[model samples]
Target: MIFQLGCSHGLPGIFACLEGAAAIHFQDFNAEVLQCLTIPNVNSNVPSFQRPALQVTKCDAGMEIHFFAGDWREIHKLLPYAQNIDVSTGKGLDAQYDIILMAETVYSISAVAHLYELIKMCITPSHGVVYMAAKKHYFGVSGGTRRFLSIVEKDGVLASSMVAEVGDGSSNVREDQTLSLFFLFLFFNLLPCGCGHQFGHLPLIWRIKYCNRN
Candidate 1:
Protein backbone atom coordinates (compact mmCIF):
# COMPACT_ATOMS: atom_id res chain seq x y z
CA MET A 1 0.00 0.00 0.00
CA ILE A 2 1.06 3.60 -0.67
CA PHE A 3 -0.28 7.00 0.28
CA GLN A 4 0.47 10.38 -1.23
CA LEU A 5 -0.46 13.31 0.97
CA GLY A 6 -1.16 16.74 -0.45
CA CYS A 7 -1.33 15.03 -3.81
CA SER A 8 -2.13 17.83 -6.23
CA HIS A 9 -2.01 15.92 -9.50
CA GLY A 10 -1.15 12.64 -7.79
CA LEU A 11 1.86 11.96 -9.95
CA PRO A 12 3.55 9.78 -7.38
CA GLY A 13 0.40 7.78 -6.69
CA ILE A 14 -0.11 7.22 -10.40
CA PHE A 15 3.48 6.07 -10.73
CA ALA A 16 2.87 3.65 -7.90
CA CYS A 17 -0.09 2.31 -9.79
CA LEU A 18 2.09 1.72 -12.84
CA GLU A 19 4.61 -0.05 -10.63
CA GLY A 20 1.85 -2.48 -9.51
CA ALA A 21 1.34 -1.26 -5.99
CA ALA A 22 -1.47 -3.20 -4.30
CA ALA A 23 -3.17 0.00 -3.23
CA ILE A 24 -2.63 3.74 -3.72
CA HIS A 25 -4.43 6.46 -1.78
CA PHE A 26 -4.32 10.10 -2.72
CA GLN A 27 -5.20 13.00 -0.42
CA ASP A 28 -5.41 16.71 -1.06
CA PHE A 29 -6.93 19.76 0.64
CA ASN A 30 -9.69 20.31 -1.92
CA ALA A 31 -12.36 17.90 -3.08
CA GLU A 32 -12.45 19.59 -6.44
CA VAL A 33 -8.77 18.93 -6.96
CA LEU A 34 -9.37 15.22 -6.47
CA GLN A 35 -12.49 15.17 -8.62
CA CYS A 36 -11.11 17.20 -11.48
CA LEU A 37 -7.35 16.62 -11.55
CA THR A 38 -6.18 13.61 -9.55
CA ILE A 39 -8.76 11.05 -10.66
CA PRO A 40 -8.37 11.97 -14.31
CA ASN A 41 -4.61 11.83 -14.11
CA VAL A 42 -4.84 8.31 -12.71
CA ASN A 43 -7.20 7.15 -15.40
CA SER A 44 -4.92 8.52 -18.06
CA ASN A 45 -1.67 7.16 -16.70
CA VAL A 46 -2.70 3.82 -15.16
CA PRO A 47 -3.49 1.97 -18.42
CA SER A 48 -7.23 1.52 -18.47
CA PHE A 49 -8.91 0.59 -21.73
CA GLN A 50 -11.88 2.85 -21.10
CA ARG A 51 -11.29 5.88 -18.92
CA PRO A 52 -14.18 6.16 -16.52
CA ALA A 53 -15.53 9.60 -15.88
CA LEU A 54 -16.12 8.64 -12.25
CA GLN A 55 -13.66 7.09 -9.84
CA VAL A 56 -13.79 3.29 -9.56
CA THR A 57 -12.71 0.95 -6.78
CA LYS A 58 -10.26 -1.03 -8.86
CA CYS A 59 -8.28 -0.53 -12.02
CA ASP A 60 -7.61 -3.02 -14.81
CA ALA A 61 -4.38 -4.21 -13.20
CA GLY A 62 -6.28 -5.01 -9.97
CA MET A 63 -4.73 -2.05 -8.22
CA GLU A 64 -6.94 -0.33 -5.68
CA ILE A 65 -6.97 3.46 -5.96
CA HIS A 66 -8.63 5.78 -3.48
CA PHE A 67 -8.78 9.53 -2.99
CA PHE A 68 -9.48 11.71 0.04
CA ALA A 69 -9.69 15.44 0.51
CA GLY A 70 -9.49 17.34 3.81
CA ASP A 71 -7.13 18.96 6.28
CA TRP A 72 -4.17 16.83 7.34
CA ARG A 73 -5.41 16.62 10.92
CA GLU A 74 -8.73 15.09 9.80
CA ILE A 75 -7.89 13.27 6.59
CA HIS A 76 -6.78 10.05 8.29
CA LYS A 77 -10.36 9.25 9.24
CA LEU A 78 -11.23 9.00 5.57
CA LEU A 79 -8.19 7.00 4.47
CA PRO A 80 -8.89 3.28 4.11
CA TYR A 81 -5.49 2.16 5.37
CA ALA A 82 -5.16 4.60 8.27
CA GLN A 83 -3.79 3.27 11.56
CA ASN A 84 -6.99 3.43 13.55
CA ILE A 85 -6.65 2.42 17.17
CA ASP A 86 -8.93 -0.19 18.69
CA VAL A 87 -10.49 1.10 21.88
CA SER A 88 -10.85 -2.24 23.66
CA THR A 89 -7.62 -3.90 22.56
CA GLY A 90 -5.35 -0.84 22.52
CA LYS A 91 -3.97 -2.01 19.19
CA GLY A 92 -3.83 -0.42 15.78
CA LEU A 93 -5.90 -1.61 12.80
CA ASP A 94 -2.61 -2.52 11.07
CA ALA A 95 -3.92 -1.25 7.75
CA GLN A 96 -1.26 1.40 7.33
CA TYR A 97 0.68 2.19 4.19
CA ASP A 98 3.98 0.51 3.35
CA ILE A 99 5.38 3.56 1.59
CA ILE A 100 4.59 7.25 1.61
CA LEU A 101 5.78 9.78 -0.93
CA MET A 102 5.55 13.56 -0.97
CA ALA A 103 7.35 16.38 -2.71
CA GLU A 104 7.70 19.97 -1.60
CA THR A 105 5.13 19.31 1.12
CA VAL A 106 6.82 21.04 4.05
CA TYR A 107 6.77 24.49 2.51
CA SER A 108 4.79 26.04 5.35
CA ILE A 109 5.91 26.00 8.97
CA SER A 110 2.35 26.26 10.21
CA ALA A 111 1.30 23.02 8.49
CA VAL A 112 4.41 21.03 9.30
CA ALA A 113 3.25 19.68 12.65
CA HIS A 114 -0.11 18.60 11.30
CA LEU A 115 1.50 16.91 8.32
CA TYR A 116 3.92 15.02 10.52
CA GLU A 117 1.11 13.85 12.76
CA LEU A 118 -0.84 12.54 9.80
CA ILE A 119 2.23 10.70 8.52
CA LYS A 120 2.65 8.95 11.85
CA MET A 121 -0.95 7.82 11.78
CA CYS A 122 -0.80 6.40 8.26
CA ILE A 123 2.64 4.78 7.94
CA THR A 124 2.89 1.09 8.86
CA PRO A 125 4.41 0.36 12.24
CA SER A 126 8.11 -0.57 12.61
CA HIS A 127 8.96 -0.98 8.91
CA GLY A 128 7.21 1.58 6.71
CA VAL A 129 9.31 4.15 4.88
CA VAL A 130 8.76 7.65 3.57
CA TYR A 131 10.53 9.44 0.76
CA MET A 132 10.26 13.23 0.84
CA ALA A 133 11.75 15.84 -1.46
CA ALA A 134 11.90 19.41 -0.28
CA LYS A 135 14.17 22.38 0.05
CA LYS A 136 16.63 22.69 2.94
CA HIS A 137 15.25 26.19 3.47
CA TYR A 138 12.35 28.08 2.05
CA PHE A 139 13.25 31.72 1.42
CA GLY A 140 10.14 33.69 2.33
CA VAL A 141 8.46 30.75 4.08
CA SER A 142 9.87 28.99 7.14
CA GLY A 143 9.33 25.24 6.64
CA GLY A 144 11.89 22.91 5.05
CA THR A 145 13.34 19.41 5.33
CA ARG A 146 15.62 20.56 8.14
CA ARG A 147 12.70 21.99 10.07
CA PHE A 148 10.65 18.82 9.53
CA LEU A 149 13.54 16.58 10.60
CA SER A 150 13.91 18.57 13.81
CA ILE A 151 10.33 17.74 14.68
CA VAL A 152 10.98 14.07 13.86
CA GLU A 153 14.03 14.13 16.12
CA LYS A 154 12.06 15.60 19.00
CA ASP A 155 9.33 13.01 18.57
CA GLY A 156 12.04 10.27 18.63
CA VAL A 157 9.80 7.79 16.79
CA LEU A 158 11.48 7.99 13.41
CA ALA A 159 15.00 8.16 12.00
CA SER A 160 15.88 10.12 8.85
CA SER A 161 18.67 9.87 6.29
CA MET A 162 19.51 12.28 3.54
CA VAL A 163 19.28 10.37 0.26
CA ALA A 164 20.44 13.16 -1.98
CA GLU A 165 21.18 16.89 -1.84
CA VAL A 166 20.95 19.19 -4.84
CA GLY A 167 23.18 22.26 -4.68
CA ASP A 168 23.27 25.07 -7.22
CA GLY A 169 26.58 26.67 -6.37
CA SER A 170 24.82 29.11 -4.03
CA SER A 171 24.85 26.97 -0.90
CA ASN A 172 27.89 25.86 1.07
CA VAL A 173 28.88 22.19 0.90
CA ARG A 174 29.28 20.52 4.28
CA GLU A 175 32.19 18.19 5.15
CA ASP A 176 29.95 15.14 5.32
CA GLN A 177 28.73 15.80 1.71
CA THR A 178 25.83 13.39 1.36
CA LEU A 179 25.50 14.09 -2.38
CA SER A 180 26.75 11.14 -4.42
CA LEU A 181 29.24 11.33 -7.29
CA PHE A 182 26.84 9.65 -9.74
CA PHE A 183 24.18 12.23 -8.97
CA LEU A 184 26.72 15.01 -9.47
CA PHE A 185 27.74 13.50 -12.80
CA LEU A 186 24.12 13.34 -13.94
CA PHE A 187 23.48 16.87 -12.69
CA PHE A 188 26.39 18.30 -14.66
CA ASN A 189 25.47 16.20 -17.70
CA LEU A 190 21.93 17.57 -17.72
CA LEU A 191 23.10 21.15 -17.33
CA PRO A 192 26.28 20.63 -19.36
CA CYS A 193 27.72 24.10 -18.62
CA GLY A 194 27.31 23.86 -14.82
CA CYS A 195 24.27 26.15 -14.98
CA GLY A 196 22.33 24.67 -12.06
CA HIS A 197 22.19 28.08 -10.37
CA GLN A 198 19.18 29.03 -12.50
CA PHE A 199 16.92 27.10 -10.15
CA GLY A 200 16.15 28.67 -6.76
CA HIS A 201 15.99 26.46 -3.70
CA LEU A 202 18.48 23.78 -2.62
CA PRO A 203 16.38 20.65 -2.95
CA LEU A 204 17.06 17.53 -0.91
CA ILE A 205 15.53 14.04 -0.82
CA TRP A 206 15.06 12.21 2.48
CA ARG A 207 14.38 8.63 3.54
CA ILE A 208 12.51 8.17 6.83
CA LYS A 209 11.84 4.95 8.74
CA TYR A 210 10.31 3.83 11.99
CA CYS A 211 12.71 3.82 14.96
CA ASN A 212 10.94 1.12 17.01
CA ARG A 213 8.10 3.47 17.89
CA ASN A 214 4.62 2.05 17.77
Candidate 2:
Protein backbone atom coordinates (compact mmCIF):
# COMPACT_ATOMS: atom_id res chain seq x y z
CA MET A 1 0.00 0.00 0.00
CA ILE A 2 1.14 3.54 -0.66
CA PHE A 3 0.27 6.70 1.24
CA GLN A 4 0.56 10.00 -0.64
CA LEU A 5 0.69 12.92 1.79
CA GLY A 6 -0.09 16.48 0.82
CA CYS A 7 -0.99 15.48 -2.70
CA SER A 8 -1.62 18.86 -4.26
CA HIS A 9 -2.16 18.91 -8.03
CA GLY A 10 -1.26 15.17 -8.22
CA LEU A 11 1.83 15.70 -10.27
CA PRO A 12 4.84 13.41 -10.79
CA GLY A 13 4.39 11.25 -7.72
CA ILE A 14 0.66 10.68 -8.12
CA PHE A 15 1.02 9.91 -11.81
CA ALA A 16 3.84 7.51 -11.11
CA CYS A 17 1.74 5.64 -8.59
CA LEU A 18 -1.10 5.45 -11.06
CA GLU A 19 1.21 3.96 -13.64
CA GLY A 20 2.32 1.29 -11.23
CA ALA A 21 -1.29 0.38 -10.45
CA ALA A 22 -0.56 0.79 -6.80
CA ALA A 23 -3.27 1.14 -4.17
CA ILE A 24 -3.01 4.77 -3.09
CA HIS A 25 -4.26 6.70 -0.11
CA PHE A 26 -4.36 10.33 -1.23
CA GLN A 27 -4.45 13.07 1.41
CA ASP A 28 -4.79 16.86 1.49
CA PHE A 29 -5.92 19.56 3.88
CA ASN A 30 -9.06 20.57 2.02
CA ALA A 31 -12.10 18.39 1.54
CA GLU A 32 -13.42 20.59 -1.25
CA VAL A 33 -10.10 20.43 -3.01
CA LEU A 34 -10.04 16.65 -2.81
CA GLN A 35 -13.58 16.51 -4.17
CA CYS A 36 -12.44 18.57 -7.09
CA LEU A 37 -9.66 16.08 -7.84
CA THR A 38 -12.14 13.21 -8.08
CA ILE A 39 -13.31 14.83 -11.27
CA PRO A 40 -10.26 14.13 -13.40
CA ASN A 41 -8.54 17.33 -14.51
CA VAL A 42 -5.25 18.36 -15.96
CA ASN A 43 -2.96 21.02 -14.57
CA SER A 44 -3.45 23.31 -17.58
CA ASN A 45 -7.20 23.62 -17.21
CA VAL A 46 -9.07 26.05 -14.99
CA PRO A 47 -10.80 24.56 -11.95
CA SER A 48 -14.32 25.06 -13.29
CA PHE A 49 -13.43 23.67 -16.69
CA GLN A 50 -11.79 20.50 -15.38
CA ARG A 51 -14.65 19.30 -13.18
CA PRO A 52 -17.15 18.70 -15.96
CA ALA A 53 -14.54 17.23 -18.23
CA LEU A 54 -13.60 14.70 -15.56
CA GLN A 55 -17.20 13.82 -14.87
CA VAL A 56 -17.73 12.98 -18.53
CA THR A 57 -14.48 11.09 -19.00
CA LYS A 58 -13.73 8.99 -15.93
CA CYS A 59 -16.52 9.18 -13.35
CA ASP A 60 -18.43 6.39 -15.11
CA ALA A 61 -15.40 4.20 -15.65
CA GLY A 62 -15.65 2.61 -12.18
CA MET A 63 -12.30 3.87 -11.00
CA GLU A 64 -11.99 3.37 -7.26
CA ILE A 65 -10.02 6.45 -6.39
CA HIS A 66 -9.49 7.17 -2.68
CA PHE A 67 -9.12 10.67 -1.34
CA PHE A 68 -8.69 12.10 2.17
CA ALA A 69 -9.15 15.80 2.80
CA GLY A 70 -8.49 17.66 6.05
CA ASP A 71 -5.77 19.48 7.88
CA TRP A 72 -2.57 17.49 8.15
CA ARG A 73 -2.63 18.08 11.90
CA GLU A 74 -5.89 16.13 12.06
CA ILE A 75 -4.92 13.15 9.93
CA HIS A 76 -6.75 10.71 12.14
CA LYS A 77 -9.98 12.38 11.17
CA LEU A 78 -9.02 12.45 7.53
CA LEU A 79 -8.39 8.72 7.26
CA PRO A 80 -11.19 6.54 5.97
CA TYR A 81 -13.49 5.10 8.58
CA ALA A 82 -12.56 1.55 7.69
CA GLN A 83 -8.90 2.41 7.73
CA ASN A 84 -9.08 3.52 11.34
CA ILE A 85 -9.25 0.35 13.39
CA ASP A 86 -8.93 -0.38 17.10
CA VAL A 87 -6.21 1.85 18.55
CA SER A 88 -6.01 -0.49 21.54
CA THR A 89 -3.97 -3.01 19.58
CA GLY A 90 -1.58 -0.29 18.48
CA LYS A 91 -2.27 -0.56 14.76
CA GLY A 92 -4.64 1.10 12.35
CA LEU A 93 -6.82 -0.81 9.88
CA ASP A 94 -4.18 -0.16 7.24
CA ALA A 95 -1.16 -1.00 9.29
CA GLN A 96 2.33 -1.48 7.83
CA TYR A 97 2.08 0.24 4.51
CA ASP A 98 4.96 -0.48 2.14
CA ILE A 99 5.72 3.12 1.39
CA ILE A 100 4.77 6.65 2.46
CA LEU A 101 5.46 9.49 0.06
CA MET A 102 5.42 13.08 1.28
CA ALA A 103 5.82 15.98 -1.12
CA GLU A 104 6.17 19.65 -0.31
CA THR A 105 4.72 18.98 3.14
CA VAL A 106 7.79 19.45 5.33
CA TYR A 107 8.07 23.21 4.89
CA SER A 108 6.06 23.78 8.03
CA ILE A 109 8.31 23.45 11.08
CA SER A 110 5.38 23.17 13.41
CA ALA A 111 4.19 20.06 11.60
CA VAL A 112 7.49 18.21 11.34
CA ALA A 113 7.45 16.45 14.69
CA HIS A 114 3.87 15.38 14.31
CA LEU A 115 4.50 14.17 10.78
CA TYR A 116 7.46 12.09 11.94
CA GLU A 117 5.38 10.57 14.70
CA LEU A 118 2.63 9.67 12.28
CA ILE A 119 5.12 8.08 9.90
CA LYS A 120 6.58 6.00 12.66
CA MET A 121 3.17 4.83 13.78
CA CYS A 122 1.96 3.90 10.29
CA ILE A 123 4.98 1.94 9.12
CA THR A 124 5.89 -1.56 10.20
CA PRO A 125 9.20 -2.58 11.65
CA SER A 126 10.40 -4.61 8.70
CA HIS A 127 10.22 -3.19 5.17
CA GLY A 128 8.61 0.22 5.12
CA VAL A 129 10.05 3.28 3.42
CA VAL A 130 9.22 6.96 3.75
CA TYR A 131 10.30 9.34 1.05
CA MET A 132 10.12 13.14 1.41
CA ALA A 133 11.13 15.94 -0.92
CA ALA A 134 11.41 19.60 -0.03
CA LYS A 135 13.13 22.65 -1.44
CA LYS A 136 16.19 24.20 0.22
CA HIS A 137 14.43 27.50 0.82
CA TYR A 138 12.00 25.82 3.19
CA PHE A 139 14.82 24.95 5.58
CA GLY A 140 16.08 28.54 5.62
CA VAL A 141 12.74 29.97 6.66
CA SER A 142 13.18 30.47 10.44
CA GLY A 143 15.29 27.32 10.39
CA GLY A 144 12.29 25.16 11.04
CA THR A 145 13.79 22.10 9.46
CA ARG A 146 17.06 22.63 11.29
CA ARG A 147 15.31 23.03 14.62
CA PHE A 148 13.33 19.87 14.03
CA LEU A 149 16.57 18.09 13.23
CA SER A 150 18.08 19.36 16.44
CA ILE A 151 15.11 18.12 18.43
CA VAL A 152 15.33 14.68 16.86
CA GLU A 153 19.08 14.55 17.51
CA LYS A 154 18.67 15.73 21.09
CA ASP A 155 16.15 12.98 21.66
CA GLY A 156 18.74 10.49 20.43
CA VAL A 157 16.35 9.34 17.73
CA LEU A 158 18.80 10.21 14.98
CA ALA A 159 22.54 10.54 14.64
CA SER A 160 24.21 12.93 12.23
CA SER A 161 26.45 10.30 10.78
CA MET A 162 27.92 12.09 7.77
CA VAL A 163 28.03 15.26 5.70
CA ALA A 164 28.69 15.59 2.01
CA GLU A 165 32.01 17.05 0.84
CA VAL A 166 31.96 18.83 -2.47
CA GLY A 167 34.20 21.05 -4.63
CA ASP A 168 37.60 20.20 -6.10
CA GLY A 169 37.25 16.45 -6.52
CA SER A 170 33.48 15.94 -6.63
CA SER A 171 32.01 13.89 -9.48
CA ASN A 172 28.79 15.90 -10.07
CA VAL A 173 29.29 18.53 -12.77
CA ARG A 174 27.02 20.30 -15.22
CA GLU A 175 27.80 21.64 -18.68
CA ASP A 176 25.19 24.42 -18.54
CA GLN A 177 27.05 27.68 -18.17
CA THR A 178 24.10 29.36 -16.47
CA LEU A 179 24.14 26.78 -13.70
CA SER A 180 26.91 26.84 -11.14
CA LEU A 181 28.89 23.62 -10.99
CA PHE A 182 29.15 22.28 -7.48
CA PHE A 183 30.24 19.07 -5.83
CA LEU A 184 27.77 17.30 -3.56
CA PHE A 185 28.52 15.01 -0.67
CA LEU A 186 25.88 12.52 0.49
CA PHE A 187 25.14 11.53 4.08
CA PHE A 188 23.94 8.14 5.29
CA ASN A 189 22.88 7.95 8.88
CA LEU A 190 20.25 6.57 11.21
CA LEU A 191 17.52 8.91 12.35
CA PRO A 192 16.71 7.90 15.91
CA CYS A 193 13.45 9.76 15.66
CA GLY A 194 12.63 8.05 12.37
CA CYS A 195 13.10 11.34 10.48
CA GLY A 196 16.26 12.90 9.06
CA HIS A 197 16.99 16.45 7.94
CA GLN A 198 18.63 17.60 4.74
CA PHE A 199 19.66 21.15 3.85
CA GLY A 200 20.12 23.06 0.62
CA HIS A 201 23.90 23.06 0.77
CA LEU A 202 23.89 19.34 1.40
CA PRO A 203 24.10 17.36 -1.81
CA LEU A 204 23.59 14.06 -0.08
CA ILE A 205 20.28 12.58 0.99
CA TRP A 206 20.20 11.58 4.65
CA ARG A 207 18.39 8.42 5.63
CA ILE A 208 17.23 6.78 8.86
CA LYS A 209 17.65 3.05 9.18
CA TYR A 210 15.87 1.19 11.94
CA CYS A 211 18.23 -0.27 14.48
CA ASN A 212 16.78 -3.55 15.73
CA ARG A 213 19.58 -4.27 18.15
CA ASN A 214 18.54 -1.64 20.63
Clashing pairs in 1: none
All candidates' TM-scores? Answer: 0.77, 0.55
Worst 10 residues of 1 by lDDT: 191-200
Query: Taking the tens digit of each residue's C-alpha lDDT, what string does model 1 give over 6-103?
Result: 87776666656766788887888998887777776675667762443434477677877777789987877777666476545322466578878777
Off by over 4 Å in 1: 49-56, 86-93, 171-202
Can you write out model 2's per-residue Cα lDDT over 164-204, one digit (the tens) per residue? 22223443311110111211211111111111223223222
Query: Who wins the TM-score comparison?
Result: 1
